[model samples]
Target: MNEVANPGSSAVVLIGTAEYDHADVERVPSVSANLDDLYDALLDPGIWGVPAENITVLRDERDPASVYDAIRAAARSTRDDGLFLVYYAGHGFPYDDDLVLGLREVDPQFPDEKGLRYPKIRQATQLAIALRRVVILDCCFAGRAGREVLDAGDAVKQIAGRAEISAEETYLLVAVGPNELAKAPLNDRHTAFTSALLHVLTTGSETADPVLSIRTVAEKVIRRVVAAGHRRPEFRAANAAVDAPLVRNARLRPHDLTGVVLEATADVTDPELRGAVILVLRHNDSGALGVRLNRDFGPLPAALDGWRDHVSLPDRLFDGGPVAQDGFISLVRLREHEERPIRFTEVTGLLGSLPLSDAQQSARDRIADLRIFRGYLGWRPGALERLVTHGRLRITDTNPFHAAFARAPFTRTGS
Candidate 1:
């Protein structure tokens, strides 16, 4: 069983709300919707290539106390090895040298509410002092959220070179540069900075590396934002390494590995029996390399539709191997016998059987769930081994986690 990994040390918090009851501007669905999208992106196991248990998400309509509690829990859970990510997306206003993140109840008449207090950048910096922190602020006037402006001579010292003595683990990325205002386009669902940020994350670039350096990602985001008709995004580091990587998971490039590939026609050949990630399989060729990934089980048998009251089977049937397209492939997970004659996919590790309806029903009852994919991914003979040897494919020693299928991918931080 591939169980999801727990958030041992890394934590993520996201806050997005546009319903400022006191403000003149009406609320927009995009604000909350974008935040939800961001939350999904961060929690995606495939995005970080780690288990989903390592992340947590908090959304709009949540009370400040609950929000703070979640943050506190994450902070306490990973005292020393903590990697914290905080994201805010909504209205922002300048307050002295810092900026304020407007809460839903904040009104223009009384923008500052004691109950919904603005978390100062300095406070965030202080929190960062105790952990590795990444902060993303997406709103108008966000650049002023940090320390006070310094004289030109002092600017370099205050913002750039002063690396010693201060909190050395915090980094910030704001939507716009200092004194620049962020624009919220009518047509675009997300702010320009945020849209660009998402594009860069999903786009597979040749120069992309696994370390996920903050500077690199920021630069790419800024460039993309400017190209998309927006001001450059602002980046700030507080006594931290500029090149420090962002993601805990190793970064993956495009040309890393070739997934599984099998012929549409059935053939019992050894050449068809290879791949680290199986793309396709025929049951006749490989005698049902059990528990295949990336193939959907067709419709369930009519007799067993409601017969098994407590168990759930896959909606679609699938060819467990590349050799038998029409034949049925079954997955069996039994409690009585721990060991069985089955080839596990390792990604999901359920045992496989060749067209055994009874065993299939039993397995369906035992696992009680299924994932159906249109096609599978596979590699030819020696292809996977060569990729691993050449450093193109990195095989993590950590085991696969089950939480990946629970939901789509999520982003740890948002623009």
Candidate 2:
């Protein structure tokens, strides 16, 4: 799960061209409303709730440098833990195998020279301090733009000498496939993709998850766009960012914390909890149960040493938390299509916990990953939520296993 970005520290830039000056380029009047409605959706408290002052909107702008400068300024201003989002709805075309955004005065035949090349936006995003970055494209050849922006294969040539941002932390959500044209019906108030997206963000989904995550929103919008006779949208996020929450769910109560990870904030001073990385095992009205992931408690006990081959990282038992220090919890990640092996109780996705009573019956071949911990972390009914609300324990919507290992793939300042 990926955590929602902190509103105060994040920035958003929206660019759209409703009326083109070039004779050969077609006008998309709906692009105007696309910007307006998206602005409202992003600012709504019930939705993502980004501050109005943090968003910059440029409509029918003739200067391409203004677009480039806005994105660069936003990226530079965002904090390391913040999120930066850039959205564009305009005419896009292929230029020398790259995507270019058409501005108000763009020449259809000379887009490479007259329009704004997407590499500039990508370069700006690549220099951001924000760990989570989003690019939403609503135009022709959007998929192509998304692909180039997310792909790191050409980062050296694109950025020249600047440090490259990790592609794993960036997300791309496009309105159409690489070969398809985005639908901007003259009869509709907004483009087909933007219309479906706005509907989901405003109405919320009926899914069990408490928050309307970025991936979930895309899934819901894709169905609507396809059903409405438009090209299918493409969403690409490779890491824990896939579960980043964008808004509160309007139709449901806050759900369980089975899949959530909670990282202690920088201000936390508790010796046992400060800088702790905890993975929630259960959560409900009663309380919450989790395990600390950053400590090791040496090798497994002699009686359970048989499973040592399957343990993750240092091949030792983890120091879960202060509670029930003698108890042991075994977690396993099942293979792609394997059935639920004996004693396995799923926590989320492919991860689950299994009792160690029958080692032989556990079916070793079905296991794709494993972790063992001693003790557990427990919190009273409302205590955990209060801590999170007060900023003591930051909620990170991410895969639990990422923090389970000794060293994670991405940089986690809190841990």
Candidate 3:
């Protein structure tokens, strides 16, 4: 699985209420349980990458002030370009040409002032500095929330379209039509809509995808829920909506190759890394460091002309991992000669590494077998290990003693 690294911070506000004061309104049996299901999904590390401190759950909050206060507090904690999601799984419906989410003490006498207004939520979401604002209204008249938020435009086709810094995306999913009743099956822990959502997350996702977007999940939920006799759920994208891949399935998690050698299996996905052998230089709790010894880019750069003939592979240079391209590294072969006036670290009796300046200081005729590398491959902690466990890599010998031109795994991307 691809590790989740958000472009910004993450904040979530989940509001659900099973208790209401109005005697005229029927209670939603699965409101609180639906929240519980979503809350559990949010806490899962294999799902959304949010830390525990970033989420807030308001269950049966009685006052509108308290609800807004908690939501604003959660929003304030998020940095710009972060994600802010608000999930409401209670009662909601069309009121005075707008939608209003019910509060714990909601009364029919004044729905506009006493209830949680959809426009207020929409306005707050639009005004928030977060880059992604998602609102999932699992209640009646949910589609009206989408109507109030989205502009009259065609929905975006591609999820990974080019991004704009000034643009913010709003993805809204409602359970029922503007005038329909939200499903609330009696004796069920969660509503049919949310239950379908859970089923999809737990089993319906396709493993081939590296990231599972909210749109994908919503579609699956809608399909299963509709097939079970519920009204068609509504999905809307406001402003510039892009795919948000927040859910993760650990069944497809990658291997962890700490301290182990990686041998590419025949089924390796990338052509560049297929049939390639690698030597694990360092794999620690912090990150992994390795180099591809097989890839040789014909001739070395003209800049390192001070002592070209001194090294065995002076004419060859390899592209390391695609990280910092400005950095240069080398692996020099050790020999039985008077050590040159340069600082070097000996890895094995026959392998050593030194600075470029030091390597250039060797005498013109001195024999210094060296391999130059531009940039270097790196994996954050367990990433390389995941690649190995995923069958993309295998373990090999640590013997640095090899041919002058060793194997290399440069030129790689999202495996």
Task: Report lDDT per candidate.
Answer: 0.49, 0.76, 0.68
Predicted candidate 1 versus true structure: per-residue lDDT over 1-415, tens digit per residue: 0111122456666777667565484565566666766665554433333124545555444355555666566555544444667777777766554566666765545454511234643453344323566678788777776644232234446656555544345667889855777766776687677776665555524453544566566777878888877887787766433335554222353232222232222222233332222332322212222223433345655654653463345554442444445444443333334443343333234422323444444434444443333223244433343233323334443222232123323221110
TM-score result, candidate 1 = 0.56
* Tens digits of per-residue lDDT for model 3, 69-153: 7788877777765778898888885788778898877876677666898887876666556766778888887777756444313
Q: After superposition, how far is residue 143 of candidate 2 from its true place, in Å?
A: 1.4
lDDT of 2 by residue, 1-415 (tens): 4345777678889999999888889899999998999998777544555778989999998888877888898888888667888999989888876789899999978887667898878898877788778888888888777454433324334445545434446777889877778888878899888899888887887776657777688888889999998888888764432356666664652356666888989878876687788888888779888888777677657776665565432445777878898788877777888788767788887787877665664476677767778888898765565466436888886667666543642222223
**Which candidate has the highest lDDT of all?**
2
The regions of model 1 sitting more than 4 angstroms off are: 1-7, 49-56, 62-66, 114-130, 148-167, 240-242, 248-415
Error of 3 at 260 (Å): 8.5
> Which candidate, 1 or 2, would have the higher TM-score against the true structure?
2
Which residue ranges in model 2 land beyond 4 Å of their true spot? 1-3, 148-168, 238-242, 252-415
**Sorted by lDDT, highest first, which candidate order results?**
2, 3, 1
The candidate, 1 or 3, that scores higher on TM-score is 3
